[model samples]
Target: MLTEDFIGRVVIVLVVTVLTTFGAIHLFVTFQQETSASSLAVVTRTGTIAFMVLQLVMTVWRLPPKGTARGIESRVTSVAGTFLILVAAFLIPAVDSETVQVTALCLIFVGTVSSFFCLYWLGRSFSIMATARKLVTSGPYSIVRHPLYVCEAIFVSGVIISHFSALMVALGVLQFLLQYRRAKNEEAILRQTFPEYHAYERTTPMLIPSLSSLDWR
Candidate 1:
């Protein structure tokens, strides 16, 4: 017997699946016709679509039971984080920055590709709200507590460089700040739930990965 709450979650999840799939197809089709598109545009569009695909997978299969949220801050910051992850790339002006180079394009691709590993490691632990699921301590998490956010910083920076816009610039900055706050709110919950979180926090920098602390192997 499916409860109303469970049915609601399923319905919302299905809706998200439809939206992300449609969004990915739309972006790809739009970009496919751009035979004259620059390398930066090509990479940015591809990166955005790849990100959407990964997010769809996470939401559909890999998510854990969402824990109790802290407060309004948790939900608000979660929305902000989602906006950055899903919508910000599309918000970037389709026009090329005219300043992009092959090197920059390469960096963008690298950031986009590298982020998948962290997402894979995160697995079912991913959540939009400040809720505890599993405390991932290996892979990129060993370096920075919020590896996904760090990766997004790199990936989004690359996208912004490829397609510059004043409004996107402001949104990017705001997203970065909100990501930090969102991560903090999550850490707060983790600290309360798990005893080991204090030591983890002490050793792991919140967002920026310290070279000295990172395991090189």
Candidate 2:
């Protein structure tokens, strides 16, 4: 016998799953609707859908209660980030997908795959806003304090470059700033919750990993 709250959670999860699946299907179908498709288009679109499915999977697993908000910063960042991502994706012209498209595809492929690495290690710990779930300090996390954000940056750089929109570039810049603040807010929570986070922070680079940041132990 499940409680109402538990049932509600299940409903929410179902709804999210449906939404993600529908969105992926919609995008894939749209790709086919195009007059012609290039390998680059196929690869990037497939990668985007793969990323979305992964997100849905992770969302279901991490359906547990999240921590209370630290402030409005994370909330704003979360909304803005989501909006920017969708806008960038749809704003991509349907045709004339040449120019830096190949390079963009490569960047997106790398970023999408790297994001999977970060998410796999993070497991059910993934969260959009700055809330302490479980601290992931191994795998990609060991490389950078915010490996997911790094991956996202790689992914979005491709979108902006391939499109080469002044507006998209501006959106990317804003997203990066929001993500930086979001990372800091998450860190504050983690540091307060887990004393060992300081040691982790000292060893790990905030965004990029290098010899100095590697915890080779």
Candidate 3:
């Protein structure tokens, strides 16, 4: 399981790096452009509905987890992230009306596509339990170890950007931090579970386009 654990840790690192880069870019843009607080309520509501649907599906489907900390932290992050998003959706006013609309569209598209890709990759091996029964190293795992979690970060960030709430943006950053911590713990457990994880780590491209790049191969 070394291959799997190593691959998982590598993917987590990549995801965190990408998020940091994106966060920097987003902050720069938001600072330059004035945001609206009026549309926050509407966007937040729609986002909440979408998030709720996803949560319900995950709950009903129930996937295995890596460890207790990973499992518990996942739920906490979800709830906290949801609450922040909801606040932006319901209470914050839209700062830039036109931009807000565009932002929402972009967020929805990116989040949906990323999330669907993760779910498809996870397939039947997906579970929400606190411990994993098997190492998933095919499909998305073959490409990036933790596609679902990576995409989740994307989704959360997208929603925050869609709402254009400064407070929510900060909270989203905190959410990511929490997620990274959880991933760190999960990776340690995965390392203990799998012996082949290191070999896989050397080959996979983490959260980037590993399989996609291989299409030409």
Q: After superposition, how far is residue 173 of candidate 1 from its true place, in Å?
A: 0.3
lDDT of 1 by residue, 15-83 (tens): 456656665665666566544445446656666667656765665664454354546777778766655
lDDT of each: 0.68, 0.69, 0.54
TM agreement with the true structure for every prediction: 0.80, 0.80, 0.61
Residue 168 miss distance in model 3 (angstroms): 1.8
Off by over 4 Å in 1: 1-22, 25-29, 32-35, 38-40, 97-104
Give me candidate 1's TM-score against the actual structure: 0.80
Put the candidates in lDDT order, highest first.
Answer: 2, 1, 3
Q: After superposing candidate 3, which stretches have Cα over 4 Å from the reference?
A: 1-44, 63-96, 124-130, 208-217
- Candidate 2, residue 89: Cα displacement in angstroms equals 1.4
Candidate 3 structure quality by residue, lDDT tens digits, 160-192: 665666687777787777656555555556666
Cα deviation at 188, candidate 1, in Å, is 0.5
Kindly give the number of clashing pairs for every candidate: 0, 0, 34
Residue-level lDDT for 37 in candidate 1: 47
Compose the digit string of candidate 2's lDDT tens values, residues 1-217. 8853345346545644655565566466666654333445656666665666676577667735345355566667765764465456654553345546677788888998889888888888776555666877887788788889899889878766655677777878888887787787788888887788999888788997898667643
Clashes of 2: 0
